[model samples]
Target: MSDLVWTRGVEWLAAAASDPRACKRDWDRGEGIALLEAGRFWDVLSVPDQLGLLTLDLLWRPTLPVPGPTLVDTAAHRVGFFLPPDPDSKWIGAGLRHAGEGSWVAVPPPYRSTRFLEWLIPPDGTGELHSPTTLELALRQANGSLSVLAPLCGG
Candidate 1:
C-alpha cells in the first residue's frame, strides 16, 4: 500500500480507541498492539484459527468478495474479523466470540504484522466491512468442512 493509503488506514483504525492519541503514542513507543474498544465504529467476530482461515478462503472465493479487516492471534489460536456494529446481531456457533457493545479487542498497527498478532487482511481506510450475513454463511460452511475433515486429519 502507498504511504498515504496506509496512513489513512492507520488513522481509521486508531479512531476506534477512546484515546486515539494514546494508541498512537504506544505505537510510536514500539508497542506491538493496542486495545481498542468495540461497538463504537465497528464490532469484531472472532473464531478459532483453523475455522477462520477456512472461512477467509471461502469468503474470498466468491465473485463478489467480502473484504474486511482481519486479525489473527497465533498465540491465542484465534482470528478476528471486523464487521459493522449491530447491537441486534447475536452470532451463535461453537468457538465463536463477538466483541461488541462494550467489549475490547487487541488491535495491531494496520501497516505491518507483529509477533503473535498479525493482520490477515488489513484495513484499506475506506471503512469497508464484511457483511454479517455473508460471514455467517461462510463460517457455517467452514465449520462443516472442518467437522468432516477432523476425523480424516485425526484432530
Candidate 2:
C-alpha cells in the first residue's frame, strides 16, 4: 500500500480511539500476522449486543484489481463476530459474506453493507496500535469519525 493510504488508516484508528461511544476491546496481536500469512485481512468489530469484542475476518484472494495500492481483489471476505470466552459463555461464531460487489452481508444476523469499521487498536494500548502512523492509516481506511486529516497532514 502507498504510504499515504497507510498513513490515513493510522490516523483513523487514533481518531476512533478518541470516540467515547467506541468500546474498548481486546484482540490477539498475532491475528494481524495470521491474517497476512493466511492471505486475508482481519478487523475487529464491537457490537452492542455482544459483551466483548468481535473479529471480522476478510478472507479474500488479495490478487484482484483494487482501486488503491492497499486495495486488493476480494475473492471472499467473511466476518466472524465472536464473543470472547467467558466463565458462562462459549465462543460463538457468525459468518458474513461479501454480497453484490463490495458489500459484506452477514448470513446469520442479516446485516448488509459494503464497508464495516473495526478497531485497529487493542484495548491494552500496547503493540502495533501504539504507532501514530499505524493509527492514522487505519482511520483513513475506516473513514471514521475521528476526522484525522489534521494530524496526518502534520497539523
Candidate 3:
C-alpha cells in the first residue's frame, strides 16, 4: 500500500513541491496503515472529536468510514494525505527568512458543530502562539506566497 500511493501521487508531489519528506518511504514498514508520511497514522475516527486541535494551517485527523463504501476504497484516498512542506520539514528556514512574508488562515473547527475558530496562524506565522506544531519558529513568506509549499497536511 505504501509503495503504491507513494509512487502515484507522492512521487511527483515530492519533486514538484521540493519536499522529499512527503515522498519518503516507510522503510520500517510498521503497522496500522500509514495515513501520512511516516508517523501520522489512520485511526477509526468516525467523527472529528478533537476540534481543539484544529488550526488554520491543515488538519490530519484519523478518520473512520462514515457508513458507505468500504475500508479499501476510503483508505486509498482519505488515509493518504499531504500538505505543503512548512517549518516542520526544516526547508522554509533554510530558504526563506521570517521577515519576507506572512499569512493568516482561520482553521475552522472540526465536527462542523463549532461556533469559534479553533486556531489561526497569523499572517506572520504566529499560530504557534497558542500551540506549537513542533517548529521553534514559523516563518511566513512575503505576501503569503510559498511558491510551492502547502500550509497544512490536508488539501
Best by lDDT: 1
Q: Give candidate 2's total backbone clashes.
A: 20
TM-score-better candidate, 1 vs 2? 1
**RMSD to native, candidate 2:** 18.9
Order of quality (TM-score): 1, 2, 3
Judging by TM-score against the true structure, name the best candidate. Answer: 1
Off by over 4 Å in 1: none
TM-score of each: 0.95, 0.20, 0.17
- Model 2: residues with Cα > 4 Å off, grouped in runs: 19-58, 62-91, 94-155
Q: Give candidate 1's root-mean-square deviation (CA, Å).
A: 1.2
Please state the error at residue 113 of candidate 2 in Å: 29
Count backbone overlaps in model 1. 0
Instruction: By lDDT, rank the candidates, best first.
Output: 1, 2, 3
Per residue, candidate 2 scores C-alpha lDDT tens digits across 102-135 of 2232211011112332322212211121122332
Clashes of each: 0, 20, 7
lDDT of 2: 0.24
TM-score of 3: 0.17
